[model samples]
Target: MSVSDPLLKSLKRFVLEFRTTNIVVTDDNENLAKLCSVLEEIFQKGIKKSKFFDKSDFFWSWVAKLPSFSKERCNPILSMVIDTVKESKKVTLDLGRGRLFIRSALMKKVLTVPVQIIAKNRQLAREVYYENDSILGNEILAEILQSLLFELTEAHFQLRIHNASFLDRTWNLPIYKQYELVPCDNLGLHVQYINGFLLVKAVEPGSVGEENDKIHAGDVIDELHGEALRGNKMSAVHNILQRYKGLPVHIHVIKGYDSQGNLYKPIHHLIEDADIDIATADELLQVKKSTSNGYKKPPHTILNEEEAEEIPVHGSEGGASHEAHYLGYVSLGIDGRVVRIEDSVQGVLKNHTQRVPVRIELTEKEVLVIDIKDNKTLLQHAYTEISACGRRTDQLQHIAYIAGETSCSLAKKFNCYVFEMKTNEEARFALCAIAQGFERTHLLL
Candidate 1:
């Protein structure tokens, strides 16, 4: 079971980096071998980049050797895998964590789900020991990262995308005026490269009449608000976001295919966000801004569309002392506060404003801090340049600095949690890198 836990985690981690690689888990040895052959045949774009000779090793010892506690601590997922092995000739991997094993014995192929991967950190035991100075040790860390990545999986859910807006009393009729804001989730535009043709990652929550028919994750979206589909997904988004800022817009989509050849179209809705209560939905509708609501007050500062084109570097910071890998989240210190929503579980029940998810970069003791829009100016005097604060030095142990806020100790804001993990110089240095990495890399809203 110990090995099972890490293997699952490792598989999850591997999948994130190599998303298009088709994976098939089987108890049969021959089937596993055939999978490798198929993988080399179809997943060729960068198949050569990821092939590790030992990647397919099914040694039985690896199954019970998780790095966590000596005793078995992984159960839920184990139960599921065991059940899957008990039945079925094959299995289908859901986009999320749970696996569906096909059982033909039942009249209809019964999809047996025995394990579920929730989106939460389940550090089975204490943090694993790692020398900060170690090389970008994927091997030593592969199992750990793999285990962790699987934890980030969750069941599919809906993303109630509505028009995003800002309120302002400065323009139009008193009730009609709004401060123009960039189209966020509400901005009737979205796209993610899956099977290919620059696509939009949008869908109606419930199986609506016909819209549901066209929605699917990998569907190639080839159209943009009447524009002939040209360029990639990000390009289309940049164009639409610039024009639709602070306005109501409609979007149309179709299934798309990648240059390498994979296709998917929606026959059902794929939910992808936190849940909301009916009352919250109703309230949101009442406050929903529309074309008639008047243009919203313009935002004072916004992410420059051009800047996004520059990111997505698959490599790490130039020749750092140690190696780093892309974790797929944008990290930055916007000027904001370290905030915690009070009674968010219940408060968000009717007000989704509280349910919007964001990441808090963690410190040594696990204290989280982030840059929000407001107080970021605090970094102005204390530092020059952007909102984050982490300067690396030769020694692996160093104090990660904070951007802005010259007058206060950014470390103090975390209270007792701040110093909990700074037990030694090495720990402090690791924490510094983590703090800065989180701020500079976390995705900004």
Candidate 2:
């Protein structure tokens, strides 16, 4: 059998959307079955044949079994088909840590078949309820079945490529490069110890470290004179550098940014004032101004009456002041003697109930909370460790709170942290960003 002209035309339009060359359309059942099997393989093993409407009986039975067919419940499947065919609506499906979206009329028609079959069979009761010509014929159905197979194959292939691109852009392993520097008077580099890594905080001009074009402020000094600098204190690193003064020191460094402009993960959290150049400083100032504008009042409210009266309002005379309050959050260190807002959610964190004021930042792999006053890192949780996050409803407008739970590896316990943002939009943005980060981490794995 051959496909009818009407069905062939419809199928060709769908095929053209994928821009696939060497088009072939036939009504051979064996070829159609092979195509369906290929689609199943592409989607991975054990995908139900009914998922793509490969079997005629299964398709009909699925329509008959729909809860919407009982008239009391609404049929979302039928509604999706109608919306997709008429308005070119698309539907997203979660697939292996990524998402797959489809917006084809032919696929929608194939999805609507079972419902149409059930409705027609019900109306044609007491008579031979054969397949209707208006809905779908056998030959045309074969062509559509083949078309859907190709559509899904192409869509899945594109989704894989997209996910790979995302992984390439977001998650990058640290690439180490070696540089041999001969100090004249000094190495002329200011270094800081952060999370057990020695980071080049600044490179003085006319120094060997600055002369080396590849070295930058955020580059990590992984090794010095073939000795690992990790887990070494600043004094130890200083002693090593002094021992090798005026001598060629072979060191291994992790570049802050790769050739393709991908930043190292550690650079995101360890950025300091010295790392900011003129252009970057201007950009950061603009961002700070915008963030400060979001909250006309302070980001946190003191629940204790005595503390509230004692502490003056921010920007008022004799008010408590600190650097980097750009986001309107109080810049209290982790151990500062400030009374914090009590957490509304119980048992989120063991022996921790106070919602401390801090600045929250999200990277591609982890969420970092930094003290706004001392710039100390209070919490760092990988996305894999974070089980879930969402907004808390007990707060007032413009005072959005977010809570996330992280599983501790050493203690084998869950620790929950709650953050307060200036606006509801900011809270939602943080929640979505974390969710996307979590999904990307799993996709890479």
**Whose lDDT is greatest here?**
2
lDDT of 1 at 53: 19
lDDT of each: 0.26, 0.41
Candidate 1 ranges beyond 4 A from true positions: 1-281, 287-292, 297-300, 304-307, 312-445
Instruction: Return the TM-score for each candidate structure.
Output: 0.18, 0.25
For candidate 2, list the clashing residue pairs, or say none: none
For residues 104-205, write the lDDT of model 2, one tens digit per residue.
212332433432443444432212123333223343443454555445344222111111111212223344566543223356677777756677767765
Pick by TM-score: which candidate is best?
2
Backbone clash count, each prediction separately: 44, 0
- Candidate 1 at 276: error in angstroms? 4.5
lDDT of 1 at 8: 37
- Writing each residue's lDDT as its tens digit, candidate 1 over 1-445 gives 1223333343444445333443333222223223222222211111111112123222111222332322444455554444443332211112011111111101121111111111122231112212232111123333444333343232121111110010011011011111111112233324444322343344333211112122333233333343434334566667774553322123333323221222211211211221212212223233232212653322111111211121221225311122111111112233222111111112222333221122233322222332233322111121111122211222122222223322232422211011112223333333334333332333321
